[model samples]
Target: VQMLWIPFWAAGIVNGVGHYWGYRNFEAQDASTNLSPWGVIIGGEELHNNHHTYPTSAKFSVKPYEFDIGWAYISLMQKVGWATVKKMPPKLQLGAVKPVADEKTLEALIANRYEVMAAYARGVRQACKEEIAALQARHADVSVLTAAKRWLHRDTEKVPAVVLPQLAQVRAAHPSLDKMVAMREELRQLWLNTTQSREQLTADLQAWCRRAEESGVAALREFSLRLRSAQA
Candidate 1:
């Protein structure tokens, strides 16, 4: 009974502490986090973010510095012919390609949309922070900058109604912000436009990459270049 209860208690910590602490490798919408890179006491369950990123992966440790005791145990069991790993998530590989997105690009984007969105958010926040600071410095009454920060990653529908006007003001002041917002929405819509045929989707994705590269924002351009070569 003690053995059973002890395992249950430790597993419970995977949820309670897992979602609230540590750093995230993938920016999943949920609050999931890794409690520790070294999954020592929790049977490698402490790497919750990696687990969420690749749910079917038998090994949770993603970074070079991380350790997965559970995966080590699994390897030992497999060597003894007692265990088998059915599926492991494929890693995304990028290579030089034409300037347009192709089927492989779409596959990679679909598999790693969360990662792209997280990167997009970070880029936007960094850009916006600089813009807001410049605005505040020029105009003492730039209190609306606070609202811009709050509405950083929110889509138009999710942004608070009261803050919409301020957000618009910020966008008007920063052309980069407008481009980032448009690029984000375009990517989201591209993914959701499932009714389009494969050929059409490929064309649309290629067009999206073209626009992203021409957008003049460094992050968007870099992401577009990366997208051109993405493969699952």
Candidate 2:
């Protein structure tokens, strides 16, 4: 269990170093800062103020006193033949010359950005659900009419216009609509197949009962005795 803590500490150091001393590209309202200090051990707990500004960053150490315990453990593990240390991707590592931003400004900016994105996602999902429900209702209406028309004409269109339009709309609104529809259809077919199998099994059981009814009681008794002997 102590070994499990190794990764946590390592991650914390990276986060601390990035936040405390690393440069902030954007002007976050919060003082969440970054450390620019080179080397592993110097990185420590990313200051809370800096994290509030740039929470997504990986490195935490920015100053000399900010010693990262996690990075130290990882280095120890690598030396002891138990672990490997990989450098952060070039995209994640900071440039030496970039300036750190104030903590309060950074925090407000990040918070506002999150709120806007979340609101937009929620709004889109709500609108999609409503549109899909309306389309389904329209499809049900056309299905009823189609059944009635088929009774009179005996020939119906292969695909209904309502279904086609609804499908197109759903596809446009939700990129995963096709996958969802396919999953639903697969589940429906599985249910139908299960029902058919259950019906066949019931019929088979009834037929077996009928055959048993025709068999002599003496034959059943002998079969029971044989079963008991086998178990023994």
Candidate 3:
């Protein structure tokens, strides 16, 4: 059993529970999921979704919060002349905020789309909490706000079907939340359509920033400014 233990755990637990549960950094094709952000348990196989997305990359962790023990081991080995690492995860570098989002902004945002989306998701959650508090003070029905905060953290498609009507109610009831959800989907378009030329894409991104800034939502304005800081 000792000889078979490691392989059995790798084949069964890693590939089994790895896909069946946990969060994803990228929108991979398959159902692969990262079993945990701290990859000590499965020796970095916990970052299964990242593995599926970047099969050739030596690193598994992509998000800043995630840790890959396997990559740490590889790094130690390389330092000692025992291993070589070629491909690695991409990173988003932010620079001074530009007057507008340009081609460089578009390139960086696309290159680090997962990280960008995660940041946006965090922004939405923060905004929702503020909005919810304000609404509660006004004696509004704040029950929906709690659920809205949870569902809004996810992409529109990822939201459960059963909660669509509730989400619709939340949108209809709250102006700030409604605008945030609508603008979140619009932000997604910057990377989704690949048919557009660089000039066209840059133009689209510039226009997106303008709309976001003028949307009257403070969160949207801040997010747009952050987008302007993306450096390729």
lDDT (CA) per prediction? 0.77, 0.37, 0.82
Stretches of model 2 off by over 4 angstroms after superposition: 2-111, 140-232
lDDT of 2 at 50: 32
Q: Which structure among the candidates has the greatest TM-score?
A: 3
Say which prediction, candidate 2 or candidate 3, comes out ahead on TM-score.
Answer: 3
**lDDT, model 2:** 0.37
Candidate numbers sorted by TM-score from highest down:
3, 1, 2
lDDT of 2 by residue, 31-78 (tens): 334443233333334343333444454433334555445467666887
Per-residue CA lDDT of model 1 for 67-163, tens digit only, reads 9888888889999999998866556677887557888788788877766666678778888777767877887655776667756565566566888
**Residue 208 CA displacement from its true place in model 1, Å:** 1.3
**Span of 10 residues, lowest total lDDT, candidate 1:** 1-10
**Which whole-number lDDT from 0 to 100 does residue 72 have in model 2?**
70
Give the Å error, residue 47, model 1.
2.0
lDDT of 2 at 130: 50
| Candidate 3 lDDT over residue span 1-232, tens digit each | 4334547766889789877789777656576888889887666777999998888899998878999888898999999999999998777788899988888898898888877777887778888888788988989878887876778756667667998898999889878878888887777876787788989989988988898899898888998898899899
The runs of at least 3 residues in candidate 3 whose Cα sits more than 4 Å from the true structure, single-residue gaps closed, are 1-7, 24-32, 52-55, 62-65
- Supply every candidate's count of residue pairs whose N, Cα or C atoms clash at under 3 angstroms: 0, 39, 0
lDDT value for model 1: 0.77
